[model samples]
Target chain A: MKAFTTHFKNSSMTTTADFTNTSSITLKLEQVSKQFGNLTVLENLNLVIEPGTFVAIVGKSGCGKSTLLRLISGLDQPDQGTVFYDGKIHRKLNGHARVMFQEARLLPWLNVVDNVQLGLGKTGKGKALEALNHVGLESRAKDWPSVLSGGQRQRVALARALVHEPRLLLLDEPMGALDALTRIEMQQLVERIWLETGFTAILVTHDISEAVMLADRVILLDGGKIDLDVKVDLPRPRQRDNPNLIKLQEDILRRVLTIPA
Target chain B: MSINWSKLTGRITGWVLPIFLMMIWEIASENGWLFSKILPSPREIVQAAIDLSISGELAKNIVASSERAGWGLLIGGSIGFFLGLVNGLSRTADRFLDTTVQMIRNVPHLALIPLVIIWFGIGEEGKVFLVTLGVFFPIYANTYHGIKTADPQLLEMGRVYGLNHWQLFSQIIFPGALPSILVGLRYSLGLMWLTLIVAETIATTSGIGQMAMNAREFMQTDVVVLAILIYALLGKLADMGVHFLEVRLLQWHSGFRQ
Candidate 1:
């Protein structure tokens, strides 16, 4: 484990130097209202995330959490207002942002390294190898994506997202399909990478415990609006079983359950 | 130093039944329990094959038939593949061409023999045209289906990663549709032989079908049987070729690996 940590640190140092221009981004969504036909998914939703901050949006299904992430990523435009990136009005697809979806979505025809290279767009086997190593998948570089476990595939997806060195990383329930142990491991890996890279991350998940475990601030959404915005002022490498963390998780869970459908 | 014993055994087992059946047929014919006038014995068929080979007739007929099939596949397969690609990738192309193609596909290609003969006049052109028509639809349908049903999620991911149109089509769309396209190729190969057999038997002078027709006029059952066996062997060889291609190309597919 110690050796793995040191190796990760060494690789990240090189990546940091290579991507020195990729500073973190500030995201601001001002009165962003989105409607699909008559069903309003997000209504005048206002949000501001500081650079390098990890924020998790926790909401029930149909609460427009994924839609909000899509809006921020510029995949979908809000009907009413604007999305600002670094105080500039962002109009088209957000070039500085990369989204990790619920499914890994790796090309089945390509091997592990080739799929990672897809993230690079052009030829860069060396850089692809580095990213694969970051995700501890360098050994399986030549293997197909179909052979990987759910967690391992998601890790490759994370590596693909990170290879671009995006200023904003949007995660739309990336770990939602993982098993309990694998999900925890992925959470730790993501947290460790986020800490090292300092990229702004916005995770949309239904798991409150996961939100508390990873994010600096947990934003609870109910009926297309933010119901609660709580700051998690905790130390790094937080223990899941820690009394304070558990109490906060339960408090958030209780609040989430109290909202009427 | 080590052989794959199980694989070897599996191959040996597959041949056992066919060899046993041939032996039975040979013994039955030798003992006069079967008449050679209707269905010739295996030995007689082999003798007929040797005679044809010695006279160079078998080689000539085989070459003629193969060339026709090859040319037809090259032209028809190329047209089908490109059309399928266009329709699969673009809604406009699909709207303009898909309905017409599907309507034409419903017409039995072999049933157009009368019109084909009239249009091209019993020459090599008619046979090649019939084979081309016969080999086109399955490929077009399968390739289009494969592309149309590609995982939208993967395409979305490709877009998010900033792949341009050409990159997305070459890297994602083409490989994703390949398995289905190969299925079309295999199906089209079978149709290629079937259409050629009909076309040749109906109006040709140089192919294996014509050789069989000539043998029938002289009551040479052995030569007729030989021709039938040749067609069967060719069809099997074509299928094996496609299977080899699938194994090589779809190594990443779990079903094709090993």
Candidate 2:
């Protein structure tokens, strides 16, 4: 373990990270820590995400995976660290980033189109339509949100989050509530959109296979710290039957299950 | 088959019960089973209504009362709504005025009819004042409550979007509070009618309530009953009118749209 840490430290000192763009220093968390009352959540966490990387945070219940996303999304404040977007400190959301929650949270009063355009400014409607077309909901623009099926509603929510063309997309277990079939479909839709848009995406999920399937890097959080950072070398449109993904999922499971409470 | 029959019977009974009650009242009065002086038969009331209708007295009284109530509601409800918004949005204003307003609300406006008469004189101004006071509280209360209860998450969303204060209120807060404000309007309508009756009773010589008072003075119980029935019917119509307006304006609202 000492030799491994020393080797990792040596690699970090020699590493000269090349960002995809000069402007894409991307998202960085430096020695971040969070505490709620007396309970410590995230402690001395550090991560550097490249632009357009699809990263998944996986952890057991109460392991502060969602807290990490919230911190990255600027929904919550950090106690003792910084969240940098493109090397500048990111503060509260000012429409450059969007978060999609487990529930669709589409305003029921609005129809499909209007809800997509919601919170977006004056020129939002056209962009919203484009987004809806991306999600295959152009025909349901005038239809009320309540009439939509669960998957369709989630798709609309996806459109709403994307309509603004945000650089950062945060998904907080968005497919957690769906059934197995719908979940798989949604997972694929998410992956396709991420590929098409090339937005920096961060997802927090409990499903290890899902993390292994969708993420470029799966960060296993245990006891409010990164337990394992596994790089998924598999290519896009990965199959569920792929042995590499299966082994990676098993490895992540082992790391999480072995963590001391 | 049984369920359909039951639904059909329910519809029939809804209309049947009222008609049956009227019939019983008519029969009891005509046969002298009930005192006719205190309670006139339905036929007498209908005849009185026809007579008033033919003379155009019912129409004139309705127009006058409606005008007073309508204008009073328009002016008073608007003031109350703006004040409520101020009270909700500004803590300084709320702290300054809430106690005073609460004290005033406690004092029944009807009981101040004599005082209002002395202050404004026995004229249109006095009657309108009474009606305005009566219609103001519900609108004010509901508006304040609506604005106060607007979802904080939506407000946070506005903050995230870089919306200015005015834009936030207009786009997010106002639309969010619309349902509550409409509810206030309904309550104000009811209060408008109540105040109009008191206003006409004490001061006005020319409205529906005044007409009812005149009929009572002349011991024309049928005319009095007809006047009251007209007032009740008109109040119901006003409620329906507001409901129609609500549907038109808030068609995007899920409750009304569905």
Candidate 3:
């Protein structure tokens, strides 16, 4: 209910971790900051992603990119500031929002498909299988998560996040644990799934190119603030070989690398 | 499944020492190196088993002991499980009763046989009470520990799901505590047998333990040995029953694999 002044810095370092314009918004955060005891992780953050948009948050290790996602996902509350979804205060994740963690975090006791359907109140077994099928893991439905490959496990996690038909999807470095080849494959799978689902996605990643390739707009966060908000303007299904994407990636990388060591 | 005897050799290896000891006992008895009054021959024990079977005494005693154990498990285990859940979930209840229960746990239930006899008068109530006391603490302690030790991360997941209190407990806390609860049940079943034996020996007029005590007075070593064997067999069967139930109930668990 309080008016929050937005600070737009000339350089990448001074803006809050999330920076968005009032001109177009679906999800918005204003003057958000979070602190744990003495350490400040997010400071006066502001951002917006339009309906069915994919936004990538890129930051160095301690810049609170994941923390920002956690706040958005309602996994954690911001100590200060308000997050709005569809003009309503984003409070907690209901069936409307779901998060996929980097570790997959599948229930080990559950089979792959059951793990996908976990905590889906009143959902049918058939629909659960359909979600697994959508993730191309129908054959491994009855298999334990422990037996699945890392890529397969992540696929199961993706299915789980999708099963509830959430309007918003939060990815917290979901591919960080996968090998290089697996990570690329999973990135492609995720991109295709996001396009198919038409769900608003906010991805937090350390990989600059991952942000550029996957996000419609990429925000580079440094020092608990958004350093730069680069619009991809690149076409849907953008390829890694696209010159503009490559240039954008180079630019984001240069901005990120210029941060104080 | 077809054949893996080499892998099973360690399990089979344990039987060798027991068989060797039994053979030595038989040889010693046959050679009169041991007094027949003190140590019955294996054949004598077998003959006593046949005699008891003819009289239907062994069957009746086994049934009696088993019934006591069954009742003890049903009542004690259920109470312990529910109470454990309370102690695990409610800090106030835990604070009030935990120290009291710990203090009571230190008093050996078997040592209270005379008191139980005086209270219940060598009746079935005393025997049942003894069995219940024997089985209660282990199940309660383990269930409490299990609930306490449930993964906090999974609990965070439950919170993210917006599960209400009952939903959280039924879906998350209960399932998480199941492995430990099952372990407790197995241990309690064993204790049930132990307590039933002590109770029957002290107070009851029937059951396997009573039959053993009766045989001892008459110097019927064969009957005593038979009763002891029945007790061992019953303990093994009770354990197996609980184990089978655990496997069926928690087939999803990783522990079920081995």
Candidate 4:
């Protein structure tokens, strides 16, 4: 993590002002409700995230965790209430935020660097190269996305998102499709970057252990409402096998499994 | 050394059957086992080609045919591609134009040859018109399909990444649809040749098809055979051109990569 921070700092010094100023963001959702047809997905949900905080929303299928992330990102609007970003009501697509979807969603026609540059909007090949370096994928910068493994593709997606130096980074099960080992490596990479960059991150995941590993606070949703909000209160560079981490994971898992359909 | 030998044989493999068949035909025609009137020997066809080239007739006909094909493809392909872009990108345009395009596509273009002759006469215009009509639909249909079916997920990603409208279309939508559009192009290229062959056969003066018709009148079976061979060669050449284009444009596609 120390080596990664120093490397990122040295490389990022040459990038533009937009890439340098990684000012974090705060989010507040008040009485937010969303519905598709007759089915209410999120019902008057209320939450607040501090700047530079890593929060994970964990729930079963259709519990509306993903919907909440979408609302925060302003990809979808709440039917009842407003989502405030840094205390201002943001009702449209959040321009200051970027999402990393479950699928890498990298354009197959573009190579690694070009895909990252998509976040920078036609300029900033240098910034994009630095972002790829941050993800340890600078060597594959000229290679097509199709040639990369699933984990590698996600890393490129990470680079694309990070190139923007977004105030808020929303990850919608971004590591769900990865294998166990790759998932761990990606989590480490994301953790290291988050610590270095200090961007607010809201991750939606089904994995309890992942939530315990990465998030400072884990928000559990049941029937479109927050059922539990647990804080890790743990140190950085968390060990997966730590007894406290294991206990927290088990506790979250039990709570998730015991929730009635 | 062994690997090189196998590679060499691999290169020769595709030509082996065609060459063997030509040799057999040559021997059979020489022995009078096959009637020369029905199918001339390969050597006779080659001699006819040589004679025509010497007289500058073959080159003239080839140039005429190529110009017709090129003009038709340029005009027809542009119109089809333009219409496809407008319709695919705009729901209003799609609703207004797609049904009419589909209706016209159903009418056999070759069946319009007589009508075309009456309208434009058996001149260059009529033949070019037929080729144009023949090549338009596949390209239009394929381009439309390609644009319409561009991955929605990628578009959403583009939007989230703050890509503007033009960037979304150019970077995400167009590239996504390209493989399908190329398929359409290949299909239309084949149609271009087929339509030209038919139109030229029915019409008045100049192309390779006309040369074949002239030879038939004079009982120069070798010249007629040569025309057919030229068409086959031209069609092969057109297919190779499209393949080359696919290789160049879709190098990022795993299917197109070596």
Candidate 5:
């Protein structure tokens, strides 16, 4: 993890994006409410995400975390709300945002490089290889997704999301399905990449520690609203065995589990 | 030269049973214990095959049959694939078109031979029509099945990745549907031969079916048997061809690997 941090620290040569200015793309969801045939999934929720900030939304199943992601990505419409990207109001998908799903969801027919290039459009060959290299999957560029391990497939998914350099990157429990060790490694990988590119990153996960690990701010969702928002003021590459981190993680977990259905 | 005993044994396994059956048939024919009228012996059939080939009659019928099947398959397969694409992509198309297709598909295509003869009048058109009808249903049904059953998760991924409509169809939907489409193709090929034989019942002067029907009129059981063997060979060859194609195209999918 520390090694990747150093690598990302020197990643000025990797990206051409102008990340010098702190003022960049921001996500604003105002009075968001969503329902499906009389079942309220989200109700009057409001949130603001500044650029270059990492935020994780932790919740139990059916807590509307995935619904929030769908609304943010323009996959689902809010019943009574508005979502603004940068300064523009979000209506239809404008190709400026990308999402990483829990299942990797790599097209089984496409090879690793082709899958990465999918979001980049037709002439995305060179950049796709670069993105694959970022995820440490350059060796498997020509291999099919069916032959890859579960972790590798998600890495490819991450690479695909990052290849196009989206202003906003939405991760819908991307690491939830991975094994313990692989999940830790992916968290580190995502951290390094996010630290490097500084894209607005939003992660929706069930794991409390995962929220504390990568997210600058952890929001605990209970019912249809944000019940708790805690900032991780600790420095990057915080030790896994740190006492303060464990306390914060435990506190968040307690809050999440104790919330009444 | 060193002998590859295992390889040789493996290669010979497939041919041994057919060769054994042929030998038994030859022996029965030689003993004069077999019926000479209804089922001509294997040796007599072979003689008839050679005679037909020498006179170029076998080649002519083979060409005629090939033309009918080839044209029908091309037309029917293309139309079915198109309809499948439209219906698979649009719910409105499915509502408008699929119900009608489902209704028509339940009817046995061969039962319509009399109607086709009336409409097309014993010409090449009637035979082609039969083969086309036979080929249509499988391709349409399988293509629809393939498209409808495409992984919804993959479709979601495609949407998130900002793929346009055409890109989504080509990159996601088409490859996902290809395996089922190939299965439909194999079934349709079998039906093509079956339908052509049925179409030949109209007493047309050409094609393998007509040749067999013509031979039956003269008690030339050998020639009749030869034509049947030709149909069998043609069906087997078509199947092998499709199997080869599946291997070539779907080497990535483990289900199609062997």
Candidate 6:
């Protein structure tokens, strides 16, 4: 944990600003509103996430949190306004973005390595194994997805999403289907990757405690708008018992559950 | 090792009845309970098989029938598979072609025998044409069903991962539809033999059907029975071939896992 903190600090301190095609990525939404027929899912929502930031969006079931991730991932376009990736208008699926679903969405016919390689495109034979190694799944590279436990498949999916080193990684309740222990393990895995690569990460989740533990910024959405956007001022390697973390969780939970007050 | 006694007994029970029936027929023939010219005894059929096989008559008829069925299946199955893919993948293709194919499917292909005879008479073409028509529907229907029913979620995953059109088709859509397509292939093989037999019996001068008819005219009941046994063997062989293919190609399927 200390090593991770030290590494992130060092990378940020370097500040090698390159305007011509660099690694740092920024995602911005400008007055984006999406509606399905008569139903308004998101309305005039605007937010910006800086390079190498980990932000978590939490909301109730109908709060359009998933819809927000879809818009950012470029799977769907906002009906009202534009989303920008590094100042370019996000229209189709952005090449730099990748989204991970709650369900692993691993292709059943392809084995573990092939599924990872699917993300890598043509020049991916070696990088696929390397990606599997990143998620500690190099040993299960040859196994079919059907044989793996749910948690293992999710790990494989994380490998697939990361293999390409996507500039923007959008996660939609990736740990929702997992058991408590597996969810913690997956959270650690995700945090480790984010710390190491420092890609702009946005996680959409309903789990409030998860939002507190992993995210640098936790944005709570009420209906179609941002209700609370709080920055975590706690120390690195946050524990459940940490009073600061607990207090923050309580504060967010209160705002999330409040009914139009 | 202890034997699975119930399974072993069940297998034996299946073989016992057919063996017993053969024994009864042999006994009935020896006792003159069977008319010798009408239904030949098992011994006479086996003797006739040995004679025809050694004289190469059985081999020639068998080859001729198989060639016609094989060619017909090849041509019809290919066309059907291609059409199925087109109709399955493209809404435009389905709109233009699917209704016609579905309508034609309702007509029993065997009913076209008279018209087919006029179109391609007593030659090998008529028999092959009948087999092709008979085999076409099942293959087409199954391929269409297979491609149509390919899981949409998987296709979405393919798109999300940035697969190109050809890669998506080859890697996801084709394999997803393979099991259903194979089911169609298996069913079509059965239809192939059935149609060929009917066609050969109705029109042609060269196959096992002709051999059986010639034997009937001479009161060669033994040879006629021999042809029937050979037909049964050929059908079983075709089934075995298809079963082998299904196992080899679909080992990933849960049904074939164990």
Which lDDT tens digits does candidate 1 get at residues B1-258?
Answer: 699999899989989999999999999999988899988899999999999999999999999999999989888898899899999999999999988998998999989999988999988998988888889988998999999988888888888899888988988889999999999999999999999888889888899999999998999999999988999999999999999999999999999998
Q: Each candidate's TM vs. the true structure?
A: 0.94, 0.88, 0.89, 0.95, 0.93, 0.91
- Candidates' lDDT values, in order? 0.89, 0.83, 0.82, 0.89, 0.86, 0.85
Q: What is the TM-score of chain A alone in each candidate?
A: 0.90, 0.90, 0.88, 0.91, 0.90, 0.90
Error of 4 at B84 (Å): 1.5
Off by over 4 Å in 1: A1-22, A119-122, B1-4
What TM-score would candidate 2 get against the native?
0.88
Give residue B3's error in model 3 in angstroms. Answer: 6.0
RMSD of each: 6.0, 4.1, 5.3, 6.0, 5.0, 4.6
lDDT per residue for candidate 3 within B28-98, as digits (tens), equals 99999988888798889989999988899988888887887888777888878888999999999999999
How close is chain B to the truth by TM-score, in each candidate? 0.97, 0.90, 0.91, 0.97, 0.95, 0.93
Q: For this target, which candidate reaches the highest DockQ against the unseen true structure?
A: 5
Per-residue lDDT for A74-119 in model 1, tens only?
Answer: 8888999999999999877656999999999999999988888894
Model 4 chain A: worst 10 consecutive residues (lDDT sum): A11-20
How close to the true structure is residue A163 of candidate 6, measured as C-alpha lDDT? 85
| Residue-wise C-alpha lDDT for candidate 2, range B179-217, written one tens digit per residue | 899899999999999889878987777999899889889
Note the residue pairs that clash in candidate 2.
none
Top TM-score model:
4
User: Using lDDT as the measure, what is the rank order of every candidate, best first?
Assistant: 4, 1, 5, 6, 2, 3
Residue-level lDDT tens digits of model 3 in A74-144: 88899999999889898876667778888887776668877776777666577789988888999999998
* Residue-level lDDT tens digits of model 6 in B1-258: 788999899889988989999999999998999998989899999999888889998889999999998999998999899999999999999999988998888899999999998998789888888888888888888888888988777776677778888988898888888888888888898898888777877767788988988888899999888888888999999888888877877766767665
Q: CAPRI band of model 6?
A: acceptable
Worst 10 residues of 3 chain B by lDDT: B154-163
